[model samples]
Target: MCRLSGTKSKKEMIRVVRTPEGEVVIDDTGRKAGRGVYLCRRLSCLEKAYKEHRLERSLKTDVAAEIYEKLRHALL
Candidate 1:
């Protein structure tokens, strides 16, 4: 018989959330009505998102400190 890995072990899954104002929120579920982008829960992915400003670029707006915190917490 063959066995398959569990969903919990899938470290490459990414979730996408839509924002209230047509923006995307990456990683956190703060109950805010905004688009969200969920990358693999990894430091490297988080760093890449921040460094590349993908979140801001995608949201088409500036990212605030609190938002960054929320993302970090979710990613961590």
Candidate 2:
């Protein structure tokens, strides 16, 4: 599900995770360890999550802008 928009389909969302080492990354295989957050495949959703600090709240850590840039590059 998309944590930002509340979209409830796994196939339509991408998983972003914060590793135990405190690195935030895109979880392509969905098997990474650590806290995870979901966002819709759209760039808007990613932006919304970034702008609102939703991912930070969900992962309980500070999210860097580079992470969102990486997501934009990967998703778009």
Candidate 3:
């Protein structure tokens, strides 16, 4: 489900993952071996998540700026 919007449709979402090694990354495959949280495929959700540290809260890891940049590109 989308963390910000509470949307259940994953067809329009992005998978952000916290790997076993504690790395936070965008899971393009959606099958990465780790914990993950979904966010709506909208710039607004991305912005809010970035500013509010929602992904970090959910994944229990620190999300880097580059990952947000990658997510921003993926949304477009």
User: Cα RMSDs of all predictions?
Assistant: 7.4, 2.3, 2.1
Error of 2 at 52 (Å): 0.7
Ranking by lDDT: 3, 2, 1
The superposed Cα distance between candidate 3 and the true structure at residue 51, in angstroms, equals 1.2
Model 3 Cα displacement at 38 (Å)?
Answer: 0.2
For each of the candidates, give the backbone clash count. 11, 0, 0
Which lDDT tens digits does candidate 2 get at residues 9-67?
66567898999999999898888999887778888888788778899899999888888
- Two-way TM-score contest, 2 vs 3, winner: 3
User: What residue pairs are clashing in model 2?
Assistant: none
TM-score per candidate: 0.53, 0.82, 0.85
lDDT of 3 by residue, 1-76 (tens): 3444643666567898888999888887788999988888879888988888898889888888899899899888
The ten-residue window of minimal lDDT in model 2 covers 1-10
The list of candidate 2 runs beyond 4 A from truth reads: 1-8
On a 0 to 1 TM-score scale, where does candidate 1 land against the true structure? Answer: 0.53
TM accuracy, model 3:
0.85
| RMSD in angstroms between candidate 2 and the native structure over all alpha carbons | 2.3
- What is candidate 2's TM-score against the reference? 0.82
